[model samples]
Target: MAYAEEYAPTTADPARIGYALVPLLDYFEGKTLMYVRGATCRGYVEWRTSMVRANHANARTEARRTRTVSSATARKELGVLSAAIGFWHREHGPLESVPVVTLPAKPEPKPDVLDRSEMARLLGGALGFYQLEWCDLETRQLHRTLKRDHSAINRHTARFIVIGRYTANRPGATMKLRWMPNTVGGWPDFKRELLYRKGSEVVESKKRQPSVRLGRAALAHFRRWKAIDDRAREDLARRTDGMATSFLCVVHWGGEPIKDIGKSFVTALDFAGLPRHYTPHVLRHTRVTWWVEAGLSLEEVADAAGMTTQMVEEVYWHRSPHFQKRAAEA
Candidate 1:
């Protein structure tokens, strides 16, 4: 699987050559290849030769969908295999003496997604019994998990959910936001937040930046969070003037910053008996699908999500189950 994944994307037209095919060398790890029926000379070579030829042909066809580089990689692998087989046959005996073995094709990579209902259920579970407070918890708690208390747990969940839904931002972007709270200082007043990007730019670090925006619910949530934060600062200022840039979310022990929300997210998932595939990015995929299903124009969705319309049309269209129905209507 690793070998195929590593080598399959080299070509532009991979369908002619199946990149998903796994070589015996891959499964063996570092083990040497064996001639199981070295005793029987004639049948082995022909079978091995036929298998190798067929494998190459299949690989060539599949490589069409992939890049030229990936196809080249598969070809190079075949060359190595051919050279090795030739050496083995020459040293031992005729080509007829080797055994035949088939390789498995590499499976096409696809986005793993949860349907809207499943996503709602997953979020609900996280809100109550899982660990995170209901979605209404302070947005910052999503990243802070120093004490592992209920507040910390709920907060961490909310942060991740926000990352998943509003922006296609990676976990690192969330970390960046948490590290620089002032970036989001002006509640509702995004214009003043010069440190942060207007929309998806805050999250997208990819070479090609996408446009992203928060939905009404998401925007309202952040507005409320800002209000709470302002109130916390006011309370702190009243108590003492010596306080430093105290965080909006802090532990009872002291105003120390919480750390390790990502790990806690994983821990909460395990506690809930959910599949290991539950990552923050998966939620982003879910949101994109939701928008597409809701009948947003591809360009509109892309603008809202801070992405090129082409990208949304190409990569994410399949994630929505309603894509076919929508396309047919169009």
Candidate 2:
């Protein structure tokens, strides 16, 4: 609790440490640091996996069952425990020795990418209306309606998709962007055609959030969004006697910032006739894949995607058209 609170304000994710620590606290209750060993860590992994799997088994739907917890989650939780112990030792120590926390092998990355046609379909779903079916309770009749009356159905999600696809930013970093510069979230500089993807005051995490230059299409969308937001703000100010204000780049119709778009994104996927397994993170993957396929140098792609060159070579170079071309020719 102390370590979590201490680093909460500085971390990009304020709740992650605390959330990971909850199960650890429950399991390690009354146990001293001396009791923490490789076997104990492995035991915790088993216990946590079984508990979550049991709950998942009780879920009534296939989708819910498929969301079972993996060993990766257990590894993260135990990593938090290890970090907490290390912090304690550094800050105030007299401990004889610290036990190493055992972790499961890292899982292989999922190979999922959206092709150009699929990308277009996804954007269409976000920007256009789709048919919705519902059963009328009184008449017991099935009805289909074109859901075009409400703008909230997919407007914010559309912006999210465009930004995510262009910037190759993580979903969280993309959603945290704003039009105006601030200390709490990233902001775009339209004149410079650059996007600062991390706040000035936020401490950098292992996952980098480097600035990226915007493409012409992305810049045009940002300009249009700014104009729309400015018009909306002015109208709201007049209606409320100059009391309305907003700074977020991605917003609903009324200018309120959207916290999460998972459900709406899934709806867009359904509308586009795509798989539900394609998550928002897949946008980043798609962008990286496209870059590699275009024969962009590893250094350039790594810098744009805020990843190390080694990672790009290891994980994405295989997608390149020129990959092993010399060897194949020989």
Put down candidate 1 lDDT per residue, 1-330, tens digits, no spaces. Answer: 322233323322222224223442542346444643333222323333334343235444565323222333443444444434554566555666554433223334355666755565455445544434334366544442212335534554655566566555434334334323343211123444222322322222232333245556766666666666667767788788755466444211133354445455655555454675466567766777778777777877786565677778887766555578756888
Q: Would you list the C-alpha lDDT of every candidate in the order shown? A: 0.48, 0.82
lDDT of model number 2: 0.82
Give the per-residue Cα lDDT of candidate 1 at 37: 30
Top candidate (lDDT): 2
Kindly state the number of residue pairs that clash in model 1: 57
Report the C-alpha lDDT of model 2 over 1-330, residue by residue, as the tens digit: 667877666776666787788889999999988779888988998888765454457678986776656788899999889888887777778557987888888778666899998887787677666667899999999998755425535788888888888888888787778888877678889889999988889888777888999999999999899898888888888888866666456545458776677888888888776888788888999999999999999999999999999889888999999899999999
| lDDT at 120, model 1 | 55
TM-scores across all candidates? 0.48, 0.86
Give the TM-score (vs. native) of candidate 2. 0.86
Worst 10 residues of 2 by lDDT: 245-254
